[model samples]
Target chain A: GAGVSQSPSNKVTEKGKDVELRCDPISGHTALYWYRQSLGQGLEFLIYFQGNSAPDKSGLPSDRFSAERTGGSVSTLTIQRTQQEDSAVYLCASSSDYLSTDTQYFGPGTRLTVL
Target chain B: AQTVTQSQPEMSVQEAETVTLSCTYDTSENNYYLFWYKQPPSRQMILVIRQEAYKQQNATENRFSVNFQKAAKSFSLKISDSQLGDTAMYFCASSSGTYKYIFGTGTRLKVLA
Candidate 1:
């Protein structure tokens, strides 16, 4: 794809329900990132994937938040037992490689509304 | 740990005017990168400009430029000849030697007609 792609642009789920968001990064990109944005707040780092290394999950707020990238192309963010506070936009980004100066391209975020 | 901060919550500028957005970050790493991203109603994050901490000269892209102060931990975005299309939420971010990014609370810029 020419740009990063995300699915389920908008989702309204009941509290305690689980939701899965998908992201497809640009071809040949070796680094991927996930972020969460609450209403009127800045983007919060969630996780990072660099090549075949173990993902950097230091930013995950809780055990309910988890993500996986398959074949180094597509990624999934799963929120278990979603809470009302989980209502936010989930963003995904990809970079050519995991370098300090690498520029990241972002996808249209998925807006999750936990009702 | 790294943290970015945007002091201004909202700003307005007339078409053809110039506006500056403020940002500051804290990090102990010496090798790092700074970035400014724009997000319109479409929700796509677009890179506006970037600065390398090691470079003393600022980075500029046409009408967009940045004033990066490494010692003060400040990075600001200046938009010259602002246009109505420039109305959007602007974010400041930083990345250390690692690939993870830390973003600041955005500034909502409204370019008035």
Candidate 2:
């Protein structure tokens, strides 16, 4: 089975430009997660989706960050007016369900570099 | 608020030796799960091991095992007969009733050949 996939493995954009990162979770996975890994820092939780609804969005660094999961399969994280501080590796993970015991499978991640 | 902490930022261990990475967390929820994830240079997070809070028995997977102290709020990962392939950044995470996980800063482990 395919693990998890993220598109545009690397993206470089102007500071004010908007960028959208896409994630394709494993088939039949109902739970998805988004995280940001800043340089030399740990993974920071962004948002989580159980089915198509996001139950937790408190991890979003700012209002410029938004994410949505559609069809309960794929998710898109959009950053509006990106700042240099937003430059980091964005990772997506998925699990069979939201159960605490379920293992989360992770994607290779999309490295976003804001100039 | 729930928080996870990895006191060691970096560490090195000789091949075939044993090393333990320390992790501590603070959570209000009594029922939860603890996890250890390994991220190599490839930037992919891999599940190393996991422990259930309700179970006092430690979890073990091949060369990896965990020392879970429920009362002390400590969860440490022990790796025996370390290999170069084991060199990576290890993250400790905890999740309570919610699905969201609180992750630690991570520990960079280097397995010397």
Candidate 3:
């Protein structure tokens, strides 16, 4: 089975620029998650989508961060006007369902560097 | 809100020896899930083991086991006969019925051969 996959393994951009990171969850996975991992820091939750239900946006660091999961298969995290502080590894994950008991399969992640 | 904590920042263990990584969490939910995830330098996160909070019996997957203390809000992962391949950053996480998960700071483990 194919694992979760992310696009542009590495991205370098100037401050105040916008970036879009894509994620392709495993086939049939109805749950998708986005997280940010800063240098030497733990994975920080960003957002989550479960089927057609409303996405959880509580973890988004700021108003500049937003995500959209279209067709219940793929997800995109958009960081508008990115700042140097936004430079980090963006990870995507998916599971069988939204159940807490299910294990989330992670992607290799996109390392976004904002200069 | 839930929080997970890993006290040890780094730990080194001799190959084939046993090592345990400590994790504690704060949560109000009674029935949930605890997980140990390993992220190597490759940046792929792998599930090491998992424990159901309601289950009294500890969860074990071959050489990897977990000490789940629901009352104390603690969960620790023990690795026996460690291998160099086991060297990675280990993160402890807890989640309730919600899809969101809270992760610990992570412990960097080094297996010396």
Candidate 4:
């Protein structure tokens, strides 16, 4: 792909339902990142994936939040039993490599709304 | 833990004027990077500029330049000859050699016609 791509640009779900957000990073990029942005807030670090090694899941907020990157290309962010407070825009970004000082390119972001 | 702060929530400037957005960050690591990103209403996060912690010279890209004071932990964005297209939410972020970027709350800039 020319740039990072996120699926379901907008999602509205019930509070108790689970939702999945997807990200397709640029082809050949080795590092991917996920971030959440609440209303009028800055981007919050969520998770990071670098070339198939163990992901940096320290920022997942809770055990209910989990993410995985398949084949080091596409990724998915799953939220279990979504809560109203979970409503926010989920962003995905990718860099050519973790070691490169190059800036990370961002996707359009998925706006998740939990009712 | 690293933290980024943007003091101004909202700012307005006339077209062709100049405006500066303030940002300060706290980090323990000596090797790190600072960045400024812009998000328009369309929801696209665009990279505006970046500064390396070891570099004393600030980073600049056309009308956008940064004043990075490592000693003070201050990084500010100065928009010269501001245009209506420049009106957007600007964010300041920091990353310690680790890839995770810590972002500030963001400052909304409006260029009045």
Chain B superposition TM-score per model: 0.98, 0.99, 0.98, 0.99
Ten residues in sequence with the least summed lDDT for candidate 4 chain B: B93-102
Runs in model 1 deviating more than 4 A are none
Poorest lDDT segment (10 consecutive residues) of candidate 1 chain B: B96-105
Score residue A91 of candidate 4 by CA lDDT. Answer: 98
Candidate 3 predicts chain B with a TM-score of 0.98
Candidate 3 structure quality by residue, lDDT tens digits, A87-113: 999999999998888999999999999
Model 2 chain B weakest lDDT span, ten residues long = B94-103
What local lDDT score does residue B21 receive in model 4, on the 0 to 100 scale? 97
Q: Once model 1 is optimally superposed onto the true structure by TM-score, how far is the C-alpha of residue A113 displaced, in angstroms?
A: 0.5
lDDT of 4 by residue, B15-62 (tens): 999999999999999989999999998888999999999999999999
DockQ category of candidate 4: medium
DockQ: which candidate is best?
1
Real contacts recovered, all predictions: 0.89, 0.80, 0.80, 0.62
Candidate 3 lDDT, B1-113, residue by residue in tens: 79999999999999999999999999988789999999999999999999988889999999999988888999999999999999999999999977788999999999998
Clashing residue pairs, candidate 2? none
lDDT agreement of model 3 with the native: 0.95
Worst 10 residues of 3 chain B by lDDT: B94-103
Judge the docking of candidate 1 as incorrect, acceptable, medium or high: high
Per-prediction TM-score, please? Answer: 0.97, 0.97, 0.97, 0.96
Which whole-number lDDT from 0 to 100 does residue B92 have in model 3?
A: 97
